[model samples]
Target: MSLPDLPTGWQVWNEEPDGRVILTFRPDVFTEDEYPAECLPTIYVTNGSRKRRPGAGQYQTEEWHVELFLEPEIEVLTETFDTRDAALEGAVDVAGRFADGDVDPRAHYQIPREDYFAALDRLTGDE
Candidate 1:
């Protein structure tokens, strides 16, 4: 998909045991490019028996359109990116944050990537 812009006030969620992440936002908030092919369009569940992705359209969405990723990651758990800017911003946010150490899955916000100092300069400066 084509890369898009990032969204503002967006947040990433990470699992505690491992270090997987889940980004929850509206699709309209991000761009196409922000999402890469490496990112899978699937969710996970702690219970209810883990079902491997049987291709597309096999999974169901939650009441809040929340994607479940029992084994979370950058792609499997991103918010539905609808806009271009938000997408780009999300890429920056993900690479910046997860590139460093893992975060608490239950945490409201995440820590920035260690080497993201350069991107942070632009990420924080963006409008």
Candidate 2:
């Protein structure tokens, strides 16, 4: 159990000046580590519109998106009722989908980077 390594097309981009970090995953690649057993893929990072859904208010809505950049060969994963540890394990298992080869740290989820930044900016008044 060390976690699957990042597949090709997965990458991370950091913008310290903007206080931002992004994780991107190609739709073609996937691993049993992150998804374990699920269907709906979610972006598992901070700074985005962490809120699952927004109301009718004027709040700028931006979901923490994790698009399936995987090639059509791979199927997307979704969430499940696994134990917290199991769920987290699944998340970690798929960690490579969001790894930063340039840095030692890896992203926690498969969410795209730019959307994460935009969601954060809206929250921190950077918007």
Candidate 3:
């Protein structure tokens, strides 16, 4: 299957044989010196099962979801889609939103971490 087009500043970080893809943004700037690998902005499109909460369930089910991550945190996520194409489209849209600075980590976190905000400042050049 063909993969969706990535945003201007993003690139394919990984592509598994099973069709899962990890896309990273501005790798040229967001290096280890500027940002930690785990905290780098990313979009993950996968058909993997939702990670179960601790002691929350027994049976595991698979679903297609587009996850928008700002470094070590999930800033946004979409409801599960039945098709990979739909998930990919959702992921692409989220990635675009991220590129345009449309996402706010604070909106998701009650109290955003200092380190995370600092990292976000560096990533987006926002003072």
Candidate 4:
């Protein structure tokens, strides 16, 4: 499937043949020097279940899911769709909301990274 136009700072990080898409925000700024590499924001579009159980999504399901994450383990939002097209649309919407600074990533962090938060605010125009 073709990817729709993404908002600024967002890019298609990877696309698998199995129809999974990974979108990342501002990779250039998420370097170890500027920002924590592990804290990079990302969106995942997949046909897997949203269940947390191990191996639950090992097999593809009929439903598609769009998951937004501030970090690898920090899921910010999740939306389910009946089709890949709908899931892609949902992912785009989530990316737009995040790029526009509507979604707060700082709240997900346990240890405050004040500098990183400030930089993120500036990048997302939340400053």
Q: What's the TM-score of every candidate structure?
A: 0.25, 0.24, 0.72, 0.91
Off by over 4 Å in 1: 1-53, 57-76, 102-127
Better of 1 and 3 by lDDT: 3
Candidate no. 2 TM-score: 0.24
Model 4 residue 3 distance off true place after TM-score fit, in angstroms: 1.0
Index of the highest-TM-score prediction: 4
Tell me the lDDT of candidate 3.
Answer: 0.69
Residue 28 in candidate 3 has what lDDT? 74
Which stretches of candidate 3 lie above 4 Å from their native place?
53-62, 73-75, 110-127
lDDT of 4 at 4: 90
lDDT of 3 by residue, 1-127 (tens): 5667876677888877645778888877676786566667777777766656664323334667677776555656555677777777777788777666667666766666778766565555555
Could you give candidate 4's per-residue lDDT for residues 1-127 as a string of tens digits?
Answer: 6889999999999998759999999999898988889889999999986678999877789999999987788898989999998889899999999999999877787888788778878999998
Note the Cα lDDT for every prediction shown. 0.34, 0.34, 0.69, 0.89
Clashes of 1: 35
Return the lDDT, model 4, position 52.
Answer: 82
Report the C-alpha displacement of residue 50, candidate 2, in angstroms.
Answer: 5.8
- Find the candidate with the highest lDDT and give its number: 4
On a 0 to 100 scale, what is the lDDT of residue 69 in model 4?
Answer: 86
